[model samples]
Target: MPGALPYWRLSGFYFCYFALLGATAPFLALYFDYLEFSPARIGELIAITMLMRCVAPNVWGWLGDYTGRRLAIVRFGAVCTLISFAGIFISKSYAWLALVMALHAFFWHAVLPQFEVITLAHLREQAAKYSQIRLWGSIGFIVAVVGLGQLFEHLSLAAYPLAIVLIMAAICISSFWVPDAQPRHRPEFAGQGRFIEQLKRPQILGFYLSVSLMQLSNGPYYTFLSVHLEALGYARGAIGGFWALGVLAEIVLFMFMAQLLARFSLRRVLLASFLITAVRWVLLGNLADHVVVLIIAQLMHAATFGSFHAASIHFVQRSFGDRQQGQGQALYAALAGVGGALGALYSGYSWSTLGSSWTFTLASVAVLAGAAVIATCLKEERP
Candidate 1:
């Protein structure tokens, strides 16, 4: 490890950032349902937030790359995100909530991709150790999901926005403690041409497409799993427990990710993650009524999110030059947002019309398609 690594500060930022996600992902849809929103309306509300990801990251990435002020951008975005999200407390109407979701998500989406660039810049030569720091995010997620689940069980779902706002405040405070680091430009990849040309390459395009599909498959899980579990007679606390179980599995994967990356090629890791994710969706859709089966499915999150995400980050770092790092990470986030929006929309419609089992079946099909793309288009490359 580098002597100068701001390890705790970097990890602290991830912890707080994802802790917000922990609060949001499991309960946001549930909160909407609590307010008597229809499944489609809930999906639309979530999609609005996701749709911002399609635009915000690119706009912020360009500014960060151009100004070489990635950390400053992260700080600004963090503050804006907190301010914008606080608008949720203003109204419960669909239109009003939709506006708030879009407003907050634009800035919220901007923070992570630029922060990713900052974290990687800080890591420098110890890039494979990225998972070591990122695992704190999983821990944060676990804490938020489990703790909030228990809390919400006792209190009202009305408190959801307030809990998230407090976590966002922590995110805002943490961003300031981390100092900035610029990416070291590598000339060897300069011949690959500009960012546009690099993106046009077959492998890069395939990798991104797979990323979108993976997120798309995750749509049903993120947008409605709590609702689905609730309808199946699980309590709010158990729903949170299930969500925490998935992140617990993710945290375990992160702990070993450096060793896994050293031993396995990124393509292999991704392919395996996709394949296992397909199975996971199948299990989630079909056997969620069975506690043991559900446990197995949740554990598969280690592959579905943890391994897939770590590999994707490493891929962007290797494929783009320092000059393009911000854009590269932004594009990754943008594509993910694209996939997530589609996932949320489709799952919302399908959940009510097709039923939970069929909706998850569709998610599995999406993951299978992503796996096929990986197998056919991506070549083996060690991280």
Candidate 2:
């Protein structure tokens, strides 16, 4: 594995991948609000995109595994995502937007899961260093959120599609630069059992289920935090600042994640992340007006996303061998899709009716439920 890390190549993919996220995730709701869609309708639109995630990743992941063309899948998905997303420029009607979201998201969501498989395979035995590479994504996210925040502040969100188009183009270009994760001739040496059999283990199922629950808890934060903050009267740049703050915390944690994983048990890391997530949601739900309270809650991103994601990636890497790599990452993405769609769908339906306080309280409850599952079922790895 000497000189192994195609650091910039892999990091560029992550950078552009999350840069697109930075453009869309924190701001899409604002764009919807700009279009005057009701909260429920906004949720529906976001949900359509998320629902695509549940299906597309597994379909593409399976294809990649069967064909051993992980990078090819990434490129095709990227190219088509950009093409499908072009539909956004043609109409703002509910039906039109819904169709565009679904079509583009189908291909967009397909890219990351397979890319994850490529990334880990590239890491070879040095998987612990994943956080370092992944941190570039956080940096890209921070830059996009803050920069785009300022841009949209001065200009209309009408500029958003163009910004995203450019970012998508960068994603397409980055895909061309990376090689296939593993050579077709090299047979997998992951473990003794077939990948499907690994699913029968309680630990494996429990971990996957826990991740979905955690992602479900993130629904409000991802879907409505912008609108919620805006309704509270924060400016767009300030709102972006809050989003950046969380990822900033994430960046710091990612820098040290290798050492943290070395010292802490995965179960311990996950349990702490989940419990703290419960607290963070409660604070965000109740304390948005207070900048200090908001900062504290944002700081929790280290646990909520950084530590939890690192642990989850390692778990999947450990679970699936070389042969099932694509599907393994795909399953993780698919389950997360299930959780995220429900989160966005439910939060959208409830936000105006139930209100932000209650919406996030429900989120808190979901995370605690995940913590309960992990405590009972996550197993220690055998020596």
| Backbone clash count, each prediction separately | 0, 0
Q: What TM-score fits each model?
A: 0.99, 0.96
Question: lDDT of each model, Cα atoms only?
Answer: 0.94, 0.90
Model 1 TM-score, 2 decimals: 0.99
Question: Tens digit of lDDT per residue, candidate 2, span 214-262?
Answer: 9899999999999989989999999999999999999999999999989
Model 1 local distance difference test score: 0.94
Model 1 clash number: 0
Judge candidate 2 against the unseen true structure and give its global Cα lDDT, from 0 to 1: 0.90
- lDDT by residue for model 1 (1-383), tens: 67799999999999999999999999999899999999999999999988999999999998998999999999999999999989888888989999899999999999999999999998899998999999999999999999999999899998888999999999999999999999998988777887998888899999999999999999999999999899889999999999999999999999999999989999999999999999999998989999999999999999999999999999999889988999999999999999999999999999989999999999999999999999999987645
